[model samples]
Target: MKTVAFVPIKLNSQRLPHKNILPFGDKPLCWHVINELINVKQIDEVYVYCSDEKIINYIPKEAKFLKRNPNLDGDLVKGFDIYKSFIDTVGADIYVLAHTTSPFLKSSTISSALLKMIESNYDSAFSAKKVQTFAWFDNKPINYDLNDIPRTQDIEPIYVETSGFFMFKQDVFTKHQRRIGFNPYIQEIDEYEAVDIDTKEDYEFALKLIKTLNENGREQHV
Candidate 1:
């Protein structure tokens, strides 16, 4: 199947202005994910979908530029709309919806997710962090009972979806108009890989982490 990856970027960020273009190590923030996608052998092509043409200067030569309607750049615009727009514009059996915010996400994990999703019976797959601590929801304990409390390690784990990537077959989206299908595959990643830069503090931490990695001569895959 023809698999394609795309990172939907908007120049104006509400939390952190022009965050996609901000300096992250040796390259812009968005450049990291684009570069990782390009290196993934499972992905046939990588594209940077943005309303602004300025992104063309930041992306690598291998990554294509996909011009999207500016109207879709609204703060209230749903991700489903953007997914549909991209699917309609580009033809592919499988579509990879990646996020520039997840700069540290590895290409090997992406390739593994794609291969696992295609090989397994699940219809879609995405990355998430497994929280195995005492959890609560609606003011009630989720994995523990008030009368009988279990050890944190023995508690049921809850999965929190991260801004890493969403892999789904074209038909999965066409059928449900959603990124996740009936039965979804969840890939667990470490805290370092789950770092998503959505706020100013996150950006600062990511920048520091990038510098630390460079100082130690560690690759992005780590």
Candidate 2:
């Protein structure tokens, strides 16, 4: 099956302006996702879907730029629409839905997730961070018994919203009309790997983390 790694980027960010183009370490944040997709052997192609000319120019030569449709570029339309638009337009057998904001994702992680999904015959798979906490809201327990909050280790593990990446079967998506379908699997990742850049604070934190890694000469995977 032909697999295309799709990244939907936008110039206007509500929390942080021009966030997609923001620098992280030696390259822009978006480059992290692009690089990972490029390195993944399963993905035959990489598409950078966006309306911004700056972002378009920033994309590497290996990636194909999918000019965003004007209708789906509005602020009111959800980001899911953009993903759907690309999936419909490209018509690939497999689609890897990725975000430019997540710079810590490793190419190996994405490859492993894709292999796992394919081998298991999963319709779709998304990354998450495992949480083992008795979350509460308004002094009431949300995901666990009220008494379980104190005994945190005993609580059942839950997958938190990581939003790192997704591996989708295009055939199932056209029928389901969403990234996730009837058969969905969760790929658990570390908390740091799930960091998404949404605000100035988020950008700063990511930059600091990247800088620390660079200074330590740690093996960079993303």
Candidate 3:
């Protein structure tokens, strides 16, 4: 299918300043995602959405870049907004929203998600991890309490949101203006593969994980 990967990023970070440019393994964190997306044969185009001229300049000249406006560059703007703008501008058959922080996510992971969406006729799909913990809210235990019998597997599982990737049918996004449209599919990703870096700690952890994978000879190349 004609799929375009739109990766939204910004130089003005809150928790970890310029975390996208930070070194991870041998290259910048953004390179990992870029390489994977670019290598994926199913993807038609790879677009890096950002406003920072310096960041945009640093991106590989080989890959296509879409310079975001200053209004879309601010921290207040939600990721969905940036994604919607790209859809409106490009109008691809399939739009994949990927995060630069998720360097560990393989091209296969992305391709599989999109394939599922296409095969099932899903409006949109996003990566997530199945959660089965004793959730709590307002200092009160939710889902299961001490009084209830412990049947962890039987409990209704919650899909923990992983901002790794999202696949949307271009027309659905144009009509709905949201990633999670009416008919959404949640692709369950492995806990180990769901690495989202929003802080310095998250960044360090991801690097360590990548290093460990490399040390174990499990590192993959695009």
Candidate 4:
């Protein structure tokens, strides 16, 4: 399949100003996911979709740069708007939507998600974290009984979707105008791989985590 992956990012950030370009470790925060995507063997091409030309310097030479409309960079613009614009610009059999905030997402994990969507009956697959602890929604207890309480592990696991990545067939996205499909598969990821650096606290914590990973030889090289 003609698989193409893209990382959608902008200079304007509401929290942690310039978080995308800020140094996460040796490289910029956004560089990690881009490097991982570039290493994916199944991916035919990797593109950094950003409005700022300066971002070209931050990304690796292997990945192509696609300048997008600045209007889509606004915080108010929905993510679907960016996907629609990019999908219209770049034609592909498969589209992998990745984010700069998810620096710890691994290439192997990404490859697994894409492979599942490609080889199976699943139309789309996205990274998620499975939580077995007690959860609540709208003042109502979830995964628990009012009369009886169960251990955290005994409770049914709830899958929480991460901003890590989303892979979908072109037809599924174009036809439904959504990243997810009717037959979606969840790619469960560990807490370490599920890290998303959005706020200042998140960024700080991620910095420490990356350092620890690298020290422990857990970091994968491209």
Q: In order, what lDDT does every prediction score? A: 0.89, 0.81, 0.79, 0.90
Across 22-64, the per-residue lDDT of candidate 2 in tens digits comes to 7777777788889888989988999998876677666677888
- What is the C-alpha lDDT profile of model 3 across 108-205, one tens digit per residue? 88878777787886889888998887777799777776787578888767787788888888877777777777788888888666878889889878
Residue 103 shift from truth in candidate 1, angstroms? 0.5
Q: Tens digit of lDDT per residue, candidate 1, span 183-208? A: 88898888889999999999999888
TM-score: which is higher, 3 or 4?
4
lDDT, ranked from best to worst: 4, 1, 2, 3
C-alpha RMSD (angstroms) for model 1 = 1.5
Clashes of each: 0, 0, 0, 0
Best by lDDT: 4
Residue 38 deviation, candidate 4, in Å?
0.8
Poorly placed runs, candidate 3 (over 4 Å): 56-62, 138-142, 145-147, 220-222
lDDT of 1 at 96: 90
Candidate 2 local lDDT, residue 74:
79
TM-score of every model versus the real structure: 0.95, 0.91, 0.88, 0.95
